[model samples]
Every structure is written in structure tokens, then in C-alpha cells.
Target chain A: MKNLNEISTRLEIAKKKIKKNQIKDNGTNAASLGKALKISTELVASVVVGSTIGFLLDNWFDTKPLLTICFFILGVVAGILNVIRSAKKMHKINKYRKR
Target chain B: MSLNPMHQFEVYRLGPEINLGSINLSFTNASLFMTISASVILFFLFIGTKKKSLIPSKIQLVSEMSYSFVAKMINDTAGSSAKPFFPFIFTLFMFVLFCNMVGMLPYSFTVTSHIIVTFVLASIVFVGVTIIGFIKHGLKYLELFVPKGVPVILLPLIVIIEIISYLSRPVSLSVRLFANMMAGHTMLKVFGGFVISLGLLGGWLPLGFSVALTGLEILVAFLQAYVFAILTCIYLNDALNLHH
Candidate 1:
């Protein structure tokens, strides 16, 4: 009975240790690279989407370059905002993991 | 060896071409590799879980590890409310992962490298999540576009920005995976061409770089799949919890 209790306690400790290592792994080198990759694409994609919408609206409204120019600026803002938002979220996750 | 690096990305039909009016449904190398990866995943899981034991075999250990990894990811990101989507998220992860890993082989075609394929997958997620948000929150789902503390004066611009960001989800999701895979493979092929062209004396440098790059590409293959799945989870969380 004593041996069984000791083994159970050891197993619990081992499980906790593994969990901690996994959490730490989340913030490691490759994971950071993944986050970097995601941010770049997010930035570019939003700009592309914004400009496409603007261009389409312009074509429909016969406004030519007017809506396109407006949306291009808006797209740039949206892209920067996206990068900041995702960066903040990542920072939060990393800080939480550290604890 | 084809000197042109872009030659590897060329899609050629394997069997007789099947054309349905303007649309071609022929079995190409991309389709073949996709089928191969799907079968490989199916076989791995089937055999892995065929027998249950206290001490699992190597295959079972790997299979179980993947299952738990995805489960934990969902739990952490989407919480318990997202439990029902586990099967979908798991399948998406495994499919993308296998497609990527299989593509790492010498002659295998990468299905996900194509923008169309990844776009379709991302569209499914985007559309499904939107439907789910509407079903769960009804008209209130439109509130997702409205910021909480924004002044009424800036609300219109903010809402437009929000909508643009929302629409970009599928684009970003699809482009990220497709671009990563395509760029990595193209770089690898370009370096390989360098190795061949440089000859025995000068080839050692690019050859060494290729070896290092192959290792990096494998890591990237795994990482991109992981990113893809986790993003899906994050999107699902937004729909389910409406935490934005």
C-alpha cells in the first residue's frame, strides 16, 4: 500500500512536469517563427482584401480611382491594426505561459 | 534533372483526362498526392487504434499524442463550448499536416501549395463560422462588427474596418499556408538546381545548404499545419464566445 501511494504521487509529479515543458515549448523558437509568418500574411491579406473591395465598389459606382484610393489608405490602416492586435494577443499568451 | 526550378510545380494528368464541359476533373499529380496523403492518414489512425493497451505501441503513442494535442489546443483556445467541433478541427489539422509531410518527399506534388485548394479550405471554415455565429447569436451577430467603446462619430469607419478585417480572414488563412509551402518548395528546387549546375568542386556549398534547408522545411511543414489549425480554433472561439 505504501509503495502504491508513492508511485501515484511520483506519477502526478511527472504529469505536471510534462505539462510545464509543453507550455514552455509553446513559446519556443519555431513557434515564434510561426507567429511571425502569420503576422506578415495577416498584414498583406487585409490590404489586398481592402483594395479589392474598394476597386470593385469604384467600378460599380463609376468613381474610377476615388474609392480605390480611399480604400487603399483604409487597407493600410487595417493591416497595421491587425498586426498590432495579433502581436498583443501573442504577447498575452506568452506572458500567461510564463506563469 | 530539369534545370528549370518551376518545372516541379507543373501539373500533368496521370490517367485519361476527364473533362466536364469547361471544368476539368482529371486525376492530376496534385489529386494523386492528396489521395495518397488521405489514405496514409486513414491507415495510420486505423492501425494505431486497432488494439488498445496500457503500454501503447509507438504508432499508438503518436496517434494518441496528436489527439491530445488538438484536444488541449481546443480547450485552451475555444474552451469547452467548442467541444463539438473537435472532430472537424482534428481532421483539418491532420489533413493539412499529412499533405505537407507527404509533399516533402522527392517526387510528391503538394496539394496545399496551390492557392485554390487552400482558399477552398479557408472558405469552408470562414462560411461555417459565420453561419455558426448567426445561428448562435441571431441578429446580435452583426454586433461583432461594432466596437464596444468607439465614439459614435468614428463608428462608421470602425465598422468598415472591422468588416474588412473579418473578410480578410479566409484570404490570410489560405494565403499563409499556400505561400509558405510554395515559397519553401521553390527555394529548395532553386538550390537543388544550383547544386547540379555548380558541379563537383563548387556544388558542396549549395548541397550543404540544401541539407540544412530540407531540415528547416520539415519543421516549417509541421509548424504551418499547426498554425493553420490554431487559427481555425481562434476563429471558432470568436464565433462561439463572441469575445471580440
Candidate 2:
């Protein structure tokens, strides 16, 4: 009975250690959720900021629609660029994670 | 008892409305919930950490788990250079987490569902990151917008694109949190109304959906808070390291 109790106690300790380690492992996975949520926001934000800046500049320069049109295109490019960079970062993380 | 789903979001003065000069400082349900969230966070953390034990109590375990979670997030996303900002990031995470979780309660208001609140938080991060970038790198912070290995001919265009992306950070960050919370809560409310109006026999379907959605929202509540903090870490990383 004493030996059996010792064995069971050891098993419980091992189980607890495994649980702790699992929690730590899960942290890295949670970050992917954050990454997924972020990409779209980054794209939308770039366009919005680009157009706002363009609209303001056009108003200041008294050139209606010209700057806005230019900025809108620039914003789209910027959004694409932002998305590309984040995707690249994600790729790097995935590679590291694989290792 | 009009069965209006939108009524859940209504804000009304809770006490004597106070106006200080040009500003209206009326206390509303939103403000009340914010206070509740903040206090709840404080209480949780305080009690959780007060007993420093090798073998933690359940409360201490929760406190420690959250601490390590945020710590790991910062270290992974922002690197050790962002350690000094841990308190700010941790507080932000807990506050948002509490607000989100508390809002899930029946008859509770979600402070984070509002753009004004999330916008303020995002703007603070935006301004802080910008200031940090400028202070750390001086004029070179502008280099953040200038991609490396670009041809001289395309430098100006690339820079403009970069600047647009950089400027979009706050709007995207704030809107993402606000929209997620707002949409989730609205969907829950809408389904809840269906459960009520349909009567018990017909209400089971919507009730089941409401149950599932509540579970999903709980997950989302935790996730949005994590995203908020992690993104802040990423921005801080960019500022601190000047990483492209």
C-alpha cells in the first residue's frame, strides 16, 4: 500500500508538471489569433489614413479631388505593403515555431 | 417593455448630470461599468498576488498565469527591450479583459463596444509609440517609413505608402476592438430577443444559438484583450528596435 501510494503521488506530480508546460506552450498559439485579427485592420487603416492625408493636403493646396485620387491609390499600395510585411513576419515566426 | 434589442446599448445619466465649463461630465452606465471593470481588476490582482506562495492557491494561480501570459507575449512580440512597458501593457490587458468579461453579464454595459473609448486607448498608444520612436531614433524614426533595398527612383512612392500604413495603426487598432465587441454584443442581443418573442416552445433554437454565442463571445473577450496588448507590444517593438 505504501509503495502504491508513492507511485500514485509521483504520477500526480508528473501530471501537474505536464499541465504547467502545456499552458506555456499554449501562449505561443494564442499569438496567432492576435496576428489574424491584426492583418485586416492594418489594411483598412492604411487606406483610411492615406485618403485623409490626401483630402487634407488637397484642401490646403486648393486642388479638389486630385490629391484625394492620388492618395487613395497610394493608400491601397500602402495597405498591400503592410499586409505583405506582416505576412512575412508571420512566415518567419512559423519557421521558428517549426524548429 | 418594448422588446428592442438596441435598448441594451442605451446610455442615460445615472445621477445628477454635471457640466464642468464646456465639458459634460455626466455619469452614465458606460462610466459605471468602466469603474466596475477597473475595480474588479484591481481586486482580482491584489488578492491573487497578496499570498506569495511556492504552491499557489487558485487565485494566485490565476494571477500568476495571467502575469506569465502577458510577460511571454511581450517577450515574444516586442523582445526584452520592451520590458519597461510591461506594467502599462499588463494593466491595459487586465482592464480590457475585465471590461469585456463583465460586459458579458446579463444587464451589463460593454464599455469597450464604444469607439470613443477604444479610440482614446489606441490614440494614446499611437502618440506614445510615435513619441518613443522619435525620442529613441530622432530624425531616423522617419526612416521607419523608408523601406530598405528600394531603388532611388521609387523611394518617394514607397515612403508615402509606408507613411500611410504607419498612420493607419491607431484607427485600425481601435476600430478592430470596438467593432468586434459591438458586433458580438449586438448579435447576442438580437438572438436573445428572438428567444423572448418566440415563446418557450419556439425559442429553443435561438436559445441554443445564444448559448453557443455566449461561449464564443467569452473566447472572443479573452482574445480581443490579448490582441490589443500584443499589438501594442508589436508597435512598441517597432519603436524600440526600429525594425522595418
Number of the top candidate by lDDT? 1
For candidate 2, lDDT tens digit of each residue in B201-232? 89999999999999989888999998889889
Task: Please tell me the interface RMSD, in Å, for model 1.
Answer: 0.6
| Candidate 1: segments with Cα more than 4 A from true spot | A1-27
| lDDT string, candidate 2, A26-54, tens digits | 55655666677789888888898899999
B1-244 in candidate 1: lDDT tens per residue? 4877778888889999899999999999989999999999999999999999766889999999999999999999999999999999999999999999999999788899999999999999999999999999999999999979989999999989989999999999999999999999999998999998899989999999999999999999999999999999999999999865
List the per-model TM-score of the A chain: 0.74, 0.73
Worst 10 residues of 2 chain B by lDDT: B1-10
Q: What is the interface RMSD of each candidate, in Å?
A: 0.6, 1.4
In terms of DockQ, which candidate is strongest? 1
Please state the error at residue B70 of candidate 2 in Å: 0.9
* C-alpha lDDT of residue B93 in model 2: 94
Query: Over 4 Å off in model 2, which ranges?
Result: A1-33
